[model samples]
Target chain A: MTGRLRALAIVLGLAALLIATVLADAARRRAARDAEASHRLLVRVIRLPDLALSSSSRWLRHPSQAEPGAALADLPAGLDVDPAGALIGPPRAVLEAGRSR
Target chain B: MRRQLALLDYAVGALGRRAGKSAALGAGLAFVVALFGAALLLTDAIRAEHERLVEEMPDLTVQRLVAGRPALIAESFADELRGLPAVRAVEPRVWGYYFFAALEANVTIVGTERADPALDAALAHGRLPREGAEVAIGEDLADHLGLRVGDAMGIPLDGDIVFSPVVGTFGGGSAIRSADLVVARPAHARRLLDVEEGWATDLAVDLTTEDEARVITRRITERLPGARVLERRLLRRTYELTFDARGGLLAFLLVPALAAFLLLAWERLSGLGDAERREIGILKAIGWATADVLAARVYESLVLSLTGAAVGIALAYAYVFWLGAPGLWGALLGWSNLRPALDLAPALDPLQALSLLGAVVVPFVAVGVVPAWRAATLDPDRAMRGAE
Candidate 1:
């Protein structure tokens, strides 16, 4: 094959390899689905919100578990904003919007 | 097919001539793709984990509101729900966060409701607590407090200290679920959390059928005027929204970077150098159709983009799944002192990857072809002269 054809082949091959890696990773995860059973039991035993975002304030750490009425009671610490903080409006807007119910 | 291959060959050769520019474009594109791909994948994985964790949550959680803040509810409320139709059980739970001044972090203390074999199976180091004074703590908490099984730790509540021996520690797949958790007997938990007698944190309502959850939620609200009934589905929805919003915010913050990438790609493709102009002129003079010239340019763009995207995606996958997403994890999830293991289950959707590729390649190819089209229509002689 010419140099140009060789280059094309290499590019295509690289792409295929990457996609195969992803698929293989997915398969590994599927095989480990039983691992989640323990997590389910843990959840039932102690029904705290997810620990993924617990590194911040109590309200921000467990937004789903936090009181909804106090959603905008305090300002989030700088750079400690969790996803729940973003989904809930900012404090000023939340106050201005008032109660919806 | 032969004609297309010939065009592709020419495009590859041309790219080789401008190797430096091609490499720069490819690297920039790869970085942008990696950022977006990793964010998308991490968000989806975390969401899936949340769903799995919440799957076993109670059908409805009832909390009392005292001036818009969560306060302890009377255990009598559980009795009110127990008599409702299709209601299976109403469990009054005792749980709250205890601020440990030693680490300046709050640890969750959950009171176990019953003696179950499942709790024993979930422990990584030892068995569940058999007594009120014995407790099970999370792995992170255990590590921080330097406590092992049979070791006692002091938790201060209201100027007094309550000591509980660590009977077990939670780890492995359940690490994310119990990273800052402490499981204790109901009496010990209430003492550690300073809860008053006859009051509980919340009521977990289980139903015979999940279909009755909405109706039960309504009845609970009507019967208990100041109660906040949180359904499992609503909590799941909140988790889903939180993940989506987190990922979306990260992507939004990178908008300027994406725009810069687009500008760079457009400049590289549209602002062809003298050599490129002359090459196109020669091709046109040699009876290469305008369509042929454009096809060759499109091919060049495709080759670079496809290669860049593939490399970026692979790097992203390794960065998140293998490397544990060092810097990006804290950024996507909250940067907390006590964080879950985040051993997120890998979930790569083919459609999501395809959409990312399309988001990058479609605009790139379009940018490349427009400039090539403009240059292709030039007079052959003027083009050979390297005219703009």
Candidate 2:
């Protein structure tokens, strides 16, 4: 009798755990669906570097014209100091160059 | 039923009495479960995010390779790709990494030949840059830099400083890789990245039919020797491979801990103490059947396994969803700074979770069986005498 009771307890406990797992998994699946939907919307709506404007205004505000005045002359090759005080350098190599400086 | 309830109650008391031993076993099991479960959850989240982003990715990416390194491709190459069959459109994309020295972050600078396609690209702000003088920033970047629409943002280029109007910030939907993105018009991107005129970072090819991806890849290769082609369909596999490798490395690091736990478990089960042996004998001497004794042992194992698993899983959930997975994130997904907006919703696959639980429980319960049976079948008198 005691043996049967202990066995039953073990089975019941396992069943409980499995039930919990299933419920949690269901909730997780719903969350995943919701997240993916939102993510799709986000990616489409907030695209970067609208090419129409990305290049046309590289220097609307020169760094040299800042209140404190940026030092544009110190920049090296593969980089351009736009009028807007933003440094546009070649991909990672220019970044490396800047880091070394 | 009453006797079974009593047995469970007794087993609980027994574990309580051996608190040190039980705690060690339970804690080890919990830690293992947490580690495995958390890794699986985080990987799933990362994969989901990647899948969402990949929908917008062009069918193929064609880039120029010079001396086995990526160099800018000419505008002519885009025209070449457009000439191919089933090739719908070829877009020359200008993108590069821009390091923000102040924040120690690398921003993705993308140059586009087309205009912001949407009526309101920055829906939150309901505007795109008005002219070449303006640029759009990702919401996270704007937050980090304390930028708002109309803020004049400046960047340092080689030998120059360029300031652009921050026309808008994009965010508040599903977190994409927009946090560190700086989108500008094509000309601005070219000048900023210093790609010479007539060259682009790469060409994004849209195919009329995806079934011809391999064929297009071959054709592009033949026409443009030394051009690297990336197919969008295969990106998921690449991401999966990367994530698997990182997960494997994490699992490998847990080997020592698991080994220690195994050793401890073996000593506790295979090397039973005299007191435990005598107690089993006392039960048998008192006319308790071998099956009853076995049941008690099984109950103990089940209780331990279930308690440990439950605690571990609960902790894993909290660790991943609530705490945001501190150590694991840095190790698994920490490569580039152009990171997707991290929104790891608590997601679990039933099959995967169940399999992990089974992996933890089955062996644990089975291992205890042999020692339990051995203890129970002993001659009651002999066990009582403490001779065996």
Candidate 3:
């Protein structure tokens, strides 16, 4: 290819690539946000209360069988998930009265 | 200096002769520069905004951590805080997430019955919400919800809905205030959330002085176990660290791509094929001084790299300030959905840009010199014969 023509091609390619990268990134971010909304909608709003109620009744029927936190036994509340002692906000958040929070 | 300038002119002509390679390399490098520089500057601007907001934030906020989760605190905590010497006022703030089923997104609902001096300072278009069941929302929220001043807003309640009168809509100096914010009286918020008379989401403590934040926080935790105390300074630090960590992650992700570009650039500039080496040899055979040869090569590198840096810096400005950085801003802020149309103030200094340019220019010039010099020093007769 001629030098000027090759240069034009490279410029066009670079512009296209950058534009594509930006659009794709934006789309991916939007999809991610939508996914998060759906997750929150499903878990927090739709099914959580029903699940809690169902679990509450199950334990009530079998009163003899109970955990230390009896109400918690029915509360699946991440029974399938591992609970970690990770605080959500600032690391400097007070952990104790005189310590970090 | 005159001689160097002449060689630089010659270098420009020479680069023009190889316009295809030069344009390709320069443009690609510019793209890389734009990506990295934009990320740095955007991160800086957002960090600055966070710092500004933190300055206005209350000194200390105390939250209840019940069963390893945040829950409501009793109003009785306010009396406990009033005993502290440094404490000026303890406000039991009633604020929580309200899932706007219509919008299908969460909007923060804040309620303060008292005359908030802070809100008054920022009160631009209208007054703060005064009476019970009165709400002063953000202008954007007002527009989105299709509500006007004096219009009543119907909030969904248990079996029956409660309507609150829209007293005012805030604008100007409200960048930190989200468009989805719904500010109301504490009584209305309590009624909306079904919170009992003595319950609150958290307590906001206004200290007599800034220095007393930590001491008062310590006292609060001592008085109340499982209470999380957040200081504005600490929150500011957290924001700085979070942005820094995100920038670090971005840099890490881009390293491979950056390295690949550098490698390709090095190979192109330093790796001379047979014809190019012969041309260098002919220049040497024709009695060109070693310094002159080196100057020409260095000038060529400078032209391309500097152009790249300049283009990069310009693009970065447009991205962060004008177009709002499309996908990148969301990544930096971690708020995917709620990024309204924001015109970010660029916090980039000329010195910072120059420093970045210096860092970029050095590598290009340094990398090109060695190979060009090596070719220049070749034995004249052998070089002409293509006998490297």
> What is the lDDT ranking, best to worst?
1, 2, 3
Clashes of each: 2, 38, 6
- Tens digits of per-residue lDDT for model 1, B282-346: 99999999999999998999998988998888888888888889888765444456776568787
Q: Comparing candidate 2 with candidate 3, which one achieves the higher lDDT?
A: 2
Query: Which should have the higher DockQ, number 1 or number 2?
Result: 1
- How good is the docking of model 3, as DockQ? 0.03
Best by lDDT, which number?
A: 1
Estimate candidate 2's alpha-carbon lDDT, on a 0 to 1 scale: 0.65
> Which docking band does candidate 3 fall into?
incorrect
Candidate 1 interface RMSD (Å): 8.2
TM-score of 2: 0.77
Instruction: Report DockQ per prediction, comma-separated.
Output: 0.27, 0.07, 0.03
Q: What's the TM-score of candidate 2 when only chain A is evaluated?
A: 0.34
**Model 3: residue A45 alpha-carbon error in angstroms:** 30
Pull out the clashing pairs in model 1: A55-B336, A55-B337
Better of 1 and 3 by lDDT: 1
Residues B82-157, model 3: lDDT tens digits = 9899888888878665655444334556677645444454343455677878887666666767888889887766
